[model samples]
Target: MKTWKVLWRVMMVLCVCVFTVNIVSYPQPEVTEVLSKYGSRSEEVRQIQTKLKQWGYYFGSVDGIYGTQTQDAVIKFQKKNGLRVDGIAGPETLAAIGISSSSGSSGSTGASTSDVNLLARTISAEARGEPYSGQVAVGAVILNRVEHPSFPDTIAGVIYQPGAFSCLNDGQFDQPVAESAYRAARDALNGVDPSGGAIYYYNPVTATNEWIRSRPIINTIGQHVFCM
Candidate 1:
């Protein structure tokens, strides 16, 4: 009976270890966070791809590129939303289409409204005119500012400070935001960063600050140039 008891205890310990591993391996929402920050695949890209698949926008695979089928779907969404029918995902187009991002974010993290809104403003100013991948990168810029020693430690401070963003200075950021902008912000709030740890971005042709110009260039998309 002593030998039997030892075998049972060993089996219980093994079972406990297996259960712990399963818990660790379970696919958490945080998986999206990992993909958001480091991954090049964008949330908007995923959203458009999913929407196109659902709404019969495209019969092809949901690749993240804004090619023909995706463009057609965007036009369809724009037509549905009473926007100018441009087969492109511009700010107006993104604004017109209602996005249904899983509110799985704030509910999961209990994030405050201000945090969410601040992120949304940044998204609106930076990536509203750009593509979905660019939106995530803009959100990453705010998060990077929080961690950087030279800038303010919060999103509101970084955004609201004088001369930080043209939109913030001219009250453009205060305008009604697109649903895509809101979703992008929520994605950022939920820890999706796309800037690849970029600390600064500027329009290269007009950049005057010598210090700003000295940083290594990372990527250029739309009108902004991102840097470390």
Candidate 2:
């Protein structure tokens, strides 16, 4: 009996250590993320986190911050070759990011005439060939901007605002839609609002526009900083 107790204790200790490693390696998500992921907070959010943990995609306390672990896991997957990581997701992320949650709708609708395609066209106009989740995020930022009263009321107007997106200024927005922009656009329109409600976004890492520094930041994601 004593040997069995010792064995049991050893197993418990090992389990604890493994759990600790996972928690430490991954940051927890913020509370709002939890609410958004499940489309409404309830016992189901906990269940989603539990599943995320099981899949090595969530590391935060099950208390539901949707914290760093979730973000890092999301970032890690996005960083991998050929993966799009917007942190928040739709079908693409659901299928590829190794995490899944219902967005309160029946997911996206009509693959042929879907918002995803509309989003794709919009993204093509704005970001064109920009790579990966950053481009997707940029598209989301523009949409977020459109939602704000301070910006234009439509995607075309905001993007076409003089010197807003250089691509638009240089006539790229009028060009044929590219595949990457389509993916990013689709992801954004699918309810993956990664910018939350940011009204402006810029790449400080590459930007030479001095005026962008004046805007107050609402959040940062990938390589872009979003502001009000």
Candidate 3:
């Protein structure tokens, strides 16, 4: 009887292990279409912002960069339109937004190219060697500041604000932007707030500002501690 009980317990343990593995291995929904966020600077994203703004959804500038305000607008639109509330401009979401793939909406470069370049430069300067998500986190912080009362209202204004970022003061912002930086900027603009809506971030090892450190921490990504 003891031997039988031992075998049954082992079987139960094995079953639990298998179940856990299956849960962990479950596939998540793949984001196959354009994922616009807070710092994304593309024509397609601009169109979404413009349409959403016209329809009383978005209220921010239509500068082709996705930001927190744009994300909120997209979510409201998606929720109201009975579409998936993921806030991503996937095929179905775009179609519902009155933008056909064949229409090639928001594709024109126009003058928004400068905004993209500027954001890419900022990301590259601040998070050159960080992980891709970390770079996005850096961009998200910039966008968060734009929406915050204490910070500037625009991307350029936030980035160029006096004594805002050390990279700008140290001439790191002048370096050529990296391709990864552009991707990271787009990710952040696409509403990927990996820092959980953080408005500030700093490396714990290098951060000397006691005030910044005193703020409530949100999360740590790469080498930076994101703060609310």
lDDT: worst 10-residue window of model 1: 31-40
Give the runs in model 1 whose Cα sits over 4 Å from its true position.
Answer: 1-105
> Model 3: runs farther than 4 Å from truth?
1-111
Instruction: Name the candidate that leads on lDDT.
Output: 3
The Cα RMSD in angstroms, rounded to one decimal, for candidate 1 relative to the true structure is 17.8
Instruction: Show model 2 residue runs off by greater than 4 Å.
Output: 1-122, 125-131, 174-176
Residue 126 local lDDT, model 2: 55
Which window of 10 residues has the lowest lDDT sum in candidate 2? 97-106
Q: How well is each residue in 115-193 modelled by candidate 1, as lDDT tens digits?
A: 5655776678666678776777788787788679988665655664456777655556656677788788777767776
C-alpha lDDT values of all predictions: 0.65, 0.58, 0.76
Per-model TM values vs. the true structure: 0.49, 0.42, 0.52
Better of 2 and 3 by lDDT: 3
Q: What is candidate 2's lDDT per residue for 140-162, written digit by digit as tens? A: 77777767777755453454355
Candidate 3 versus the native: TM-score? 0.52
Please give the lDDT score at residue 104 for candidate 1: 26
